[model samples]
Target: MPVPAKRRSSSKGRRGRANKGLAKKTLAKCSKCGKPTMPHHVCPFCGNYQGKEIIKSKVKKKAGSKK
Candidate 1:
């Protein structure tokens, strides 16, 4: 059994737990387009993540009537 000379500070043990909050990126910026995106998720502006297309936004082509 190990004994501490004085009161083992809670700060030492809190490093791992408290540091986790500060360890994460609050907002992930998109590389394709400069927009704020959530971590591990596709960018809403660029629709990409992890060098792959994740969110597929469709654009409807307009139909032309023959005269």
Candidate 2:
């Protein structure tokens, strides 16, 4: 059986693992609401995609504020 000839250094091991960390999410500005959102996806704030309304975002009312 083959085995490691020398013990791997902690710094080298950490360096290798550095690339394994989570990457930052790529986001684009919403055309309608001007909010940050994922590219090619519907804007959660305005529900617009590619300058069109894809989702009809509804405004939620406070439970205590009733007519």
Candidate 3:
């Protein structure tokens, strides 16, 4: 195997790795509940996709304090 003729600079290495950093996720707004969600995917909050309801979400009741 061949080795490098000289030591690589930290800035050069960092420049090469610049594109390897994690990118921000792309999100889209849900048509039904108006929540942020991934595009072309089912909405978790309203369970809607492409103007249709894919899942039937259940309403949770709030617990009352006992007197």
> How far is each candidate from the true structure, as Cα RMSD in Å?
9.0, 5.9, 6.3
Task: Give the Å shift of residue 56 in candidate 1.
Answer: 1.7
The stretch of ten residues in a row with the least summed lDDT in candidate 1 is 57-66
Tens digits of per-residue lDDT for model 2 on 6-48? 9999999999999997799999998888889999898887788
- Please, what is the whole-model Cα lDDT of each candidate in the order they appear? 0.68, 0.83, 0.81
Q: Clashing pairs in model 2? A: none
Candidate 2 similarity to native, TM-score: 0.60
Candidate 3, pairs of clashing residues: none
Q: What shift in Å separates residue 59 of candidate 1 from its native position after superposition?
A: 8.4
Top candidate when judged by lDDT against the true structure: 2
Which digits, one per residue and each the tens of the lDDT, describe model 3 over residues 28-63? 999988889999999977778999988865421112
Which residues of candidate 3, in runs, are more than 4 Å off? Answer: 1-19, 58-67
Which structure among the candidates has the greatest TM-score?
A: 2
- Shift in Å, residue 55, candidate 2: 0.7
Question: What digit string (tens of lDDT, one per residue) describes model 1 on residues 1-67?
Answer: 9987787578877875776666655898887776788887888765688877776633211223333
